[model samples]
Target: MNVRKFIAATARDALRKVRETLGPDAIILSNRGIPGGVEIMAVAARDMELIVSPRDSVRPPGGTDAPAGGAAPELTRGADRAATRPAEATLRKPASSWRPDAEVPLPAATARPLTDAPPGGEGTSAAAGAAVVPAAVMDEIRSLRRIVEQQLAGFAWGEVARSEPVKTEILRQMLGAGFSPRFARELLAELPRELDAAQALAWVRGRAERGMLTIDGESDIVDQGGIYALVGPTGVGKTTTAAKLAARCVLRHGARKLALVTTDGYRIGAHEQLRIYGRILGVPVLLARDAKDLRATLHDLRHTHMVLIDTMGMSQRDRMVGEQVAMFRDSDVRTLLLLAATGRGDTLDDVVRAYSGLGLAGCILTKVDEAASLAASLDVVIRHELRLYYVSNGQRVPEDLHLPNRPYLLHRAFKDLPESSPHRLAGVEPGLMMAGGGEGMLSVGGQRG
Candidate 1:
């Protein structure tokens, strides 16, 4: 690759030089400070691409200036032009003592063959056998790129914190309330920059509230009357939520129209628990061990106005989750994933991803009363765009289950932790948390209104 070394009194100046010369498409190979200024090694993006994937540089055995078939003509022209140009040449010097006095030329491209010719000489086979970049080299390049990107990101986030204190504060508050950094950052990306702290907070709240998908009265499952399955990870209160839905259905359409089914034969007494709920509500409880049994049971209960299935609750990592999803999907049962409000943010994300194969009809928030904060649950819901159907806060079959209260939920989600709370994020902790995980931190200069 034709790498060039540029030096200036500051990184910004050095980068400007790179951009001016390389058309803003230069790939920074290395950047560091020198004795009196900053030094950067960079290559034109097009040149780097040729080296990165050398097939475009490979020529036919006839020795003509033709690239292998399927290579871009522009790239071929550039490769030819590069062959005649003198690469950057500079004396190697210790960065600690080096000074920017003269231009340093890159090494000749011919010295480093883009692709190695096979023993039979440069032939069609040689063109086909293009050089493969070493895994170690690629890994090192990625590591270097990531380090540069993170450094730039940290600097940019620091700038945001300085210039947009309200955004930074609200981000801290969101993290303290257990909202994922990805969601919080995304929601705040559109906040008008002119808004004050209170206005910004209000805007963020309004945005979050609007993003949340909730079930309306007309779309309530009990009123609509169809087969629905409550599915989620173990200990998320799926069985209890199922009973609550059953009771609601019974009250709305009478006991004859509601039937309870359990696919949780794995847990001892699991069926018995659903059967108890059924008996108390004067509803019939049936067991369906597998897909076949589930199909037959659904066929038998076709006349019922509503059938609520309590599925086996396994760990999201359990392979059987896929099977359960397939069973419900094949039976045409709409699934409502039961997510515990108290679960950790990462755990909730995992559950949603695991059960989201064939797609969920919606989701139900469980253990709302037990959670210290509803931000995590609501965050996942809004991000995954899952429709919130019901909120289960207590053990009471019907009394505790109610339609989603959007206002209350939104209020609870943005509720800050107590000042004395140890879990509350303060100072730079929030910024670090948002920037720590590499998964979803927006890049520097990313879209943020």
Candidate 2:
């Protein structure tokens, strides 16, 4: 087998070299990142053919060929050991000689992440030394190219500022509200083709409200009550939100109807803090360290009308979130992911994606009053299709939490407007927006999908 190594400053350049030197039918054995650049292993298809096949019609790995008028090959310990032998032996064969699959080992690509494979890859290594096909590598390359194009297609605001001052100002308002650039650009793209300045915002405000989802028609979470567990990253006001839900339950029904259970055993004095709130509300607080403990605790509090579980604080990046989510499998509990409105749009998007897969009932947006703009968090909620159950603006127990109002949110988007707004759009002439080759135009069809 003739193996060659190609090194370049980038994967693309290295791959180009492999194609030029080894021809189109070069098999890539492995690739790795080094201090200066990337390293790729390649060999010509003909060379690989000599090494991988013992006969003209080569037998596939882990399979056997039948001789004429003979029974299937008998299984034996000796045959099994030969089948599992290392690939190094096949590679170390006498120069320019063919070998069987018995000595070939699995390719290194199988051990690395899917992304570590060659860019324009198709199909796996055939019999250890077979060259990878273009079909496999091109699939990943196409995907990467699409992503790059999408990012480069973002709204070029700097060029837009040269003309169309009115449309530019509308974009300014969207960004000022703390919405993500991708989301803000998509929203503006959906506007009417010939819309005037006055009509532009009215169109967007209506679209945003319709996009919002909710658990019940009203914001009252108790309307569809069950075992509710508040799960999210640290410092999103899960405890306070849980307390507020308990307070509402207590006010609507009596103390006997509400029960507070906490699984926050990690933080120091965490259970103690929940117990203090339990004392204030005159409700019992229970602790559960593991899945079994949680099941037992809920079983003991089975008679209670509403059980609010205050979960421990954890980073969304932690793998334990999957374990924590799985704990509710044995029990009948609905998950409510808590989010902070002050969070960045990208962070909120990641948080929602991480928690949304757990069959969440909905989400509660907290610290709205502290957020410079609610668009950041709201954009993520709308994009992920997660329903908004409640919004918290203050520290007050039950008073701060309220149902989401579309009209109120729309009003807030355009709040504190300058008096010159009406006159701003009066000066721009027609066709000025298209002056810069139309690249500055918002991609009207690019919605949150």
Candidate 3:
């Protein structure tokens, strides 16, 4: 059974992708549009077996609950006759009498629609797999699908989640912890049937831990040498995060090995805030008023082990973000996005999409202390394949920011779960951290083979 999510620029393109990944038998479960394109959720025909049995499979002849053949019930006899009628008819027609172009009527429920049929024409022939409904008919079908998917997106998710106990429990935990319902559904769509509830949850938690990239770099990134800049939407704590990074680098490598630069002349005292932190940490702070100044500053700071740039905060809607990204890209600066965990999942998704072209060097999670749930932030990181280098929960210089062990963070996601709740997932077990983890969070400039 295989369930997958696909995104593309158009319905046609997305459906084509669905066919390629999930095969011709894929059933589209849901779809909706986002910032730049469409998102479609589909399950392969085999995956649909989880919901319904195969049509060709038979479960013993006759009604098994019946008496030992006192007599087959009348309804049962009728069903048996109906089932064999088609085969009887086919056998009665000799091959020599069959016409090549003759159209045989078929039951509408079992009939395969003809492909390439003219608009409004009756279906006359069947293609290999697709029902070649008229273009207008297809359009109407797709439109109806979209409507149903949209309506079903929010309503009645519980009924689907309740199909199986283990998955239901896992879904309860995930939803309670603030994970998106779509994300929760996809995660547990293919649970192993053999495992008990505890083992299943352990596997799920282990899976989530593995998907998150937790690095071992000294203080996340400052230990490794690089010219980097923190970029994100306003109020995500980019400047504060920059200061925290600078402080960490200063502690390990000393003030002499690092430099602080700011390109935030737009905000009154933006540079001043970093400058104050620089003074406390005894690191030099420079201001780059524009891209020209930024390039010049990078040239001078080339001798430093790590140059941490604090760029101005702007809404993702601003054009300045692209300009800043351009500056960082041209100067060989690794850009790190500061994400606010407190923000809504959709906003986080939007921010990641808006800044994705920056060639992000991983992410720094901020405001973990404030967010009611980290699900949205984590979801964005995992879905976008963004590397998470560090997390900050407070304003205590380098003290609040550090790289968390993947298991520790994964455990924290489920820490507040109720013990008596139907979904009692005991945090991600420790041993599985290594056995089931390590698929994400690459170090700067590193790629998984």
Task: Give the candidate number with the greatest TM-score.
Answer: 1
Query: What does candidate 2's lDDT look like per residue over 214-266, in tens digits?
Result: 75455465755578999999999999999888888888887888889999888
For model 3, where is the 10-residue window of minimal lDDT? 440-449
| Candidate 1 vs. true structure, TM-score | 0.68
Candidate 3 ranges beyond 4 A from true positions: 1-163, 415-449
| Clash pairs detected, candidate 2 | 27-131, 87-105, 120-137, 120-138, 121-136, 121-137, 122-136, 122-137, 189-444
Positional deviation of residue 357's Cα in model 3 after best superposition, in angstroms: 1.1
- A best-first ranking of the candidates according to their lDDT comes to 1, 2, 3
Question: Candidate 1's residue-wise lDDT over 186-303, tens digit each?
Answer: 8877777788988988888999988889988888888888898888888888888888888788877889988988888887787998888888999999999999999999999998
- The global C-alpha lDDT for each of the candidates, from Candidate 1 onward, is 0.72, 0.63, 0.62
lDDT for model 3, on a 0 to 1 scale? 0.62
Clashing pairs in 1: 87-106, 88-105, 88-106, 89-105, 89-106
Show the lowest summed lDDT stretch of 10 residues, model 1. 88-97
Evaluated against the true structure, the overall lDDT of model 1 is 0.72
Clashes of each: 5, 9, 2
